[model samples]
Target chain A: MNDLGWIDAALTAARPQAVSALLRYFRDLDTAEEAFQEACLRALKTWPQNGPPRDPAAWLIMVGRNAALDEARRKKKQTELPEDDVLSDLDDAESALAERLDGAHYRDDILRLLFICCHPDLPAVQQIALALRIVSGLSVKEIARAFLVSESAMEQRITRAKRRVAAADVPFEAPGAPERAERLGAVAAMIYLLFNEGYSASGGSVQVRVPLCEEAIRLARLLLRLFPAEPEIMGLAALLLLQHARAKARLDGEGNIVLLEDQDRGLWDRELIAEGLALLEKALRHQRPGPYQVQAAIAGVHAHAAQPEDTDWAEIEQLYGALERHQPSPVVTLNRAVAVSKVRGPAAALAMIEPLAQPLAGYFHYFGVKGWLLKELGRADEARTAFDRAIALANTPAEAEQIRQHLDRLKEGAQRKSGRGSAHPAQS
Target chain B: MLYAILCYHDEAEVGSWPKEKDDAVLAKRALVTDKLAAKGRLGPVVRLMPTTAATTVRAGREPLVIDGPFAETKEQLLGFYIVDCASLAEAIEAAKGMVKDGGGAMEIRPLRLFRPGTTAGALAAESVAP
Candidate 1:
């Protein structure tokens, strides 16, 4: 629909692999990042007219590498730098560049780059942030928004990350099993974080940030290909797929958070459900489950349900119990409380999470869950207070609105019980 | 066939190496390196100075000189290895077992092959191919 139709498609298709390859070549995050940007600049100028090349990833990698190198050289000649237009016209050399960099060379460069980004030295946050910024080509502002950090802070974080990699001089080679295993956890964690950023959107924006989810899924698939028999990796990929399947029903028409039990089952993406289900089945066949696989299996059960009532709440609760065994945390307990409510009523669920209050005091979801449980227990006063706290801690406007809805419902219920008119104006 | 086992550590990661932990780490590294040398895999093991001794240069501009590392952060390159091995997989497998002295960190990368008559593209292809 836009002027540069084919070019856009080509860039979209090639970007992940191309950027992955460039990252391998440069080893430095900034260098790889700058190279990809340079490639895009050239593509915008050239691909509109001469058309995309035979292999877009290869084309981009080759041209991007040359452009990056040229820029490096040009920096050396900065005072006598060539005219801007002449330097930019290098975009026209796509075919020659592709001819020079083709086939197997292309594949390894990218694989190496992906491997490097997963270096065991970086923390999970830095690893994911670096991959998103360097490999997926997200801007600092965009990444910062996803992380709820300031742009300058995120920029500093990424800059520091790149410097660390450079100082480490992390190699550009496919590591063996032991090394791969250590790095794999980091890579899998990064991909999952990428998907979560997309999945957790508060639904206020018109654009759903679906591309990030798609990119994460694509990277997960690519990673699984690299390590086909790793059970945890299989679990990680399946988990994302299953979770992503429910994207459609997560938000309501007014963009409020729709609890899973309240979602319209028919609206869920069946194709994604089918793929996710198939993947979970395959992962289970490994007969060696990890936390991610167990979580995916739980998601699978929810996805298979035709209606909220049909959901196998007991089974879901059991899976959450297992997940806790595998990776214990208050968050897992908080999630299990929902399923506990379904199986054993609100009182049992309340008992389960109350012990968690001290640790989870500042957590929005914890208070939100507490508010919902208290409301279900006919404890309106306590519920309103919890909802007020939840609203105060809300990460987005939609979250605040969701808590307000609970408060409004509680007020309406109280008015009906007393046979008296409501005193306060209700939020929609 | 020489492998460089480089140690790595993230500055902000929880749980630094304690004294007993440092002793255990050194013991493990010594054990692994001895095992490698026993099997004729170890070439030379040397720990690099911290990133404080590092310098970086792009293509130009007086190398944009700075004090210490280009970026200031907690993670640093601790050390490395040069070992003889038949293949990359073997080298990397050995490298993974190499830990930081005093609980620092390490990483392993096969030296990029810079053969005569081969273009950078050809070498890049061979090194990078999946």
Candidate 2:
């Protein structure tokens, strides 16, 4: 408690709960934020000398509510101050909540706090910004740096998002089961979007924003805490963990993209792998297979294999099939084709993705995979054409460079042969 | 021997709980503590702040600071209890009694106490007693 670092952490850990409870009191985002800040300021002054409160959130809530009410009264606002007995009732409620409130109610409070930030009315960027600002307690400057935007712009964006949430009149009452599930789905998707915002940055123009990924993980963990029994939430957390476990090995020191098969397995974070596997196993036991669970299971298989040669591509292909059944998409099939190439022959894989040409024409990975399959089949000219199109469609310089490597191989294969080509250029 | 029983749990839910709910949890655990206290075996019990509020200082060739607990364990260490135990088996038994139903682990470690100011060079001359 005497340590400033500890105080900082305690305040951060207490933010969602204190702010949400304050929101319950004031029913306004700005007011709740101001009150929580005030409480934190007071904690800094008092806690170092006296030691931490038994329950930091509860202490902050009581103090914040009083501070807000006092300010309102001092300003002589018409905001009806509850009678003195009402104050006692507030204390009674806080002190006797074991008899009044169950774990589910508090869970909803936190969920509602998170769900409000990700209202459907908000755009994807705004939703991510708001969640980082409110739920994760990221400073505007910190978030701006992560997203590569100006601090003022990020602050304005968060402010606008919060205003939109308030204008949407999102009901604060504990939602019905169906509505709660719907809100949870939206929240989960928003978190995934946040993670992808960071995870998708492959260096170059957009520097890899690891903090965004870390913050997204923290938000997922917080959501898991609120809904421990939800298997999909478990899968969601597991997926992020397993994917992030390979973060260090995903790119080389030269900032070139490293394919999963080419990655150094020893660089992967084993602790995260173990935690992810534990969560995935627990989720699978629930028998409620969702998209996230299937994806996590795929990552799980990759994690279980120590070496690329030991990879169970067959299981990965099957999982992708199940994923398609759950949520059909051409992109998913394109990903599955790469696995098909590893398990079956290149011809089989090429035939599989032949139909995806129109649907995935604009997708970079589609052409990249097509080129790889064509190269494996010793179709030099066709592989070169596919590699050319892939380079054109690549999102980053690193992506373009990978395709360029394939094109270079095609050129070498053509040069060494007197005629066009026979087959198996690499083998020869 | 003295054993330090560390409690690890997912503190996101516990830390954010309201006063009465937090009290109810502690009181229920007090049921286990009461027996130990009666036997004069319990030394001290502490409930710590969540890991979010933690900071780590690395004492390498050059001092460095980092945010968060930097703990490698899956669950965060939420609290601890010091108790007098006859043997490692006794410490394990004490730990099992303290573990409430949840997703966490209890690690019991043998400890030594050093009273720095008791003598000119007070090493482990006097151990903590309850």
Candidate 3:
């Protein structure tokens, strides 16, 4: 690997521990971040010459702490700071901190930092923005592009989140078991949002933003390590893996959206699917079924089917029913309707979602599904109207193109009928 | 660290409880508080009257006085406890003890001493030793 490539990987891996440990020392987000940046600058200068340190995280934490102190001292003294060479040599302090960085301390520091970023006082948007900026270390401009917002707006949002967190007075110490359990739900939700931010790809090329998905998976794995026996966490990790396994087949050659049933199954990642299935099996055995477990069970069912025709639609429908009971919402009902259509028929599925029309009027998938069901039932006029609505609500060009394809099929069918009518006027 | 555990319960359900039932719940809370006191984690406990007795002040070009809680939710804040603990887990454990059998939820928020212009050097030196 190239020198800078290895340095990048080392920096990304060391970020959580180094930044968290520095946060522990500094007790301020901005200070901790500035210290981390200074340490990184030092590493960029020294690692190329001295080779990498034995423990990059420990070295960064020690060096970052001292660098921040040096800055404070420099500001107080109003004199020249120390030379780069003097600051970069840290053989003794690095090993000393490495000795003190025990497993419990490391886990708690990382968890504490995550909890601070996802503090309950902040709104969901702010939580996501802060976590992306602090934990994943995404640049403000990149995050702004992902969310389709101005960089200044995202910067303001992150600053406001930090201010709220500091004002809320999050504890600096390691959380206890009960507190960890309490915070797990919020943390899980944040991770899911992170994954969705990458998975949805509402704007821009999805291939370029797939790193968010990988980062989210890494965070979920870290959470799984902390709560190994927690079934919901296992289910969550499994769910993301199963969904992401199909990423390669999610679009066609021209980048048009491909429905799950039409996608090439061979393109799916078998390793990720295998890992997800194993986790789902373990989670189901735990029997403490929650929303995540139910959703994972549904995804597991889909993954197990080698071909679309072999899918157990009945089981998927039942799982969605269980999910609906566990977490009742209009969106959940709309999803369950898809399984309903597969198990029963279009008529039954249409009736199932008829009551959801008012609530899901603005929902894109609702109209798309309604249009498909209408088309199946030979209700051409209503189907066309629904497809039009779906196109209007589409969030991406691919989504709109999917609906337009349906409209094109409808037009073709109409033209064939009219041409047959011209040939056989008595039958018409 | 200090945390305030705010208890929320459906007002209508709480209002319908019998006197003896209410007394039993309060008795359970007292037991938890006594245990916390023994552990030297107990802090000030405040039990507020219902939202009906609340008055809200809104400032604008003309100050407006509004009656009742800030927002109408099914659950209303009924009481609170400030507890001293080493971590959030301890505070949550303490809060659980109070609301074990009570049909309500508690929210734990860490209390901050807002000190502006505080440098990190002093805190770092005090907390970390080489």
Candidate whose TM-score is highest: 2
The clash tally of candidate 3 reads 0
DockQ of each: 0.01, 0.05, 0.01
Q: What DockQ does predicted model 3 obtain?
A: 0.01
Indicate the docking level reached by candidate 3. incorrect
Task: Give the DockQ-based CAPRI class for model 1.
Answer: incorrect
State which candidate has the highest DockQ: 2
TM-score of chain A of each: 0.78, 0.88, 0.87
Off by over 4 Å in 2: A77-102, A202-204, A412-428, B2-4, B8-10, B13-130
User: For each candidate, C-alpha RMSD in Å?
Assistant: 21.3, 13.0, 22.4
The alpha-carbon deviation from the true structure for residue A274 of candidate 1, after best TM-score superposition, in angstroms, is 1.2
TM-score of 1: 0.62
Query: What DockQ does predicted model 1 obtain?
Result: 0.01
**TM match of model 3 to true structure:** 0.68
Q: Would you give me the overall lDDT of model 3?
A: 0.74
Name the better of 1 and 2 by TM-score.
2
